[model samples]
Target: MPKITYITFDETQYDVEAKEGATVMETAIKNGVPGIEAECGGACSCATCHVYVDEAWAEKTGEPGAMEEDMLDFAQDADERSRLSCQIKVTDELDGLVVRIPESQA
Candidate 1:
């Protein structure tokens, strides 16, 4: 399992172990991490699962596809590092990934 850290706008953080194939949003919801509503349930239709990839981990998390980028427009505070957690699949390389949840999702 890969260990992922989710940092909230309030500065609170939750570190959870996730299966390699699970999406970041899935791991978050399973662990009851706040700030990720995931309203679209892993579909690329909603931006409720928006999160900011920590600067150091941004490149590793990769860029979003066209559909996901479109949905991000609806997310508050969307920026270059912004991503839909539901679209980020967990992998061994992401073992120590850190993502910050926006205040809007709070």
Candidate 2:
């Protein structure tokens, strides 16, 4: 299991033990973490599950694909670090992944 930390707009942190192969949005939703709406149900068609990947983990998480980047245009406060949680897969390599939920979703 990977340990994922979700930081809310107000800086509230929710650390969860995420199952391997599950998307970050799924882990957050299943663990009751606030701020990730995931309205598209991990379909990668919406920005409701937007999150900012910590700079330290950016390279490991990789860049967003064209489709995901397009969807991120709809995300509030989208930036270089912005990523849709639904598009982030969990793995042992991401053991300490940290993401921050934008205030718009808080």
Candidate 3:
């Protein structure tokens, strides 16, 4: 498992272990990270799982796929670092990764 830390806009943080092959959103929802609704069950149909990848992890995570890129269009306050949590698959190399949750989702 990888330790992923979700940092809220208000500075609150929730750290959870994410198993390989599970999406980041799955670890988040499982650990009660506030703000990521994952309303579509990570099917890429909803924009509720929005998150801002920490600058350090952005390059490692790579660019979003076409579907995630399109769904990001509907997210609140999407930016260059914005990503749908469902698109981030967990991996051991992602240990200690940090992501920031937007206020809009809270």
- Candidate number achieving the greatest TM-score relative to the actual structure: 2
Model 2 regions more than 4 Å off: none
Best by lDDT: 2
Task: Write the residue-wise lDDT of candidate 3 on 23-79 in tens digits.
Answer: 989989988899999999999989899999999999888899999999999999999
| Cand. 2 Cα-lDDT | 0.95
lDDT of 2 by residue, 1-106 (tens): 7899999999999999999999999999999999999998999998999999999999999999999999998998899999999999999999999999999997
TM-score, every prediction: 0.98, 0.98, 0.97
Off by over 4 Å in 1: none
Worst 10 residues of 1 by lDDT: 35-44
lDDT of each residue in 1-106, candidate 1, tens digit only = 8999999999998999999999999999999999889887889888999999999998898999999999999999999999999999999999999999999889
**Per-residue lDDT for 76 in model 3?**
93
Worst 10 residues of 3 by lDDT: 89-98
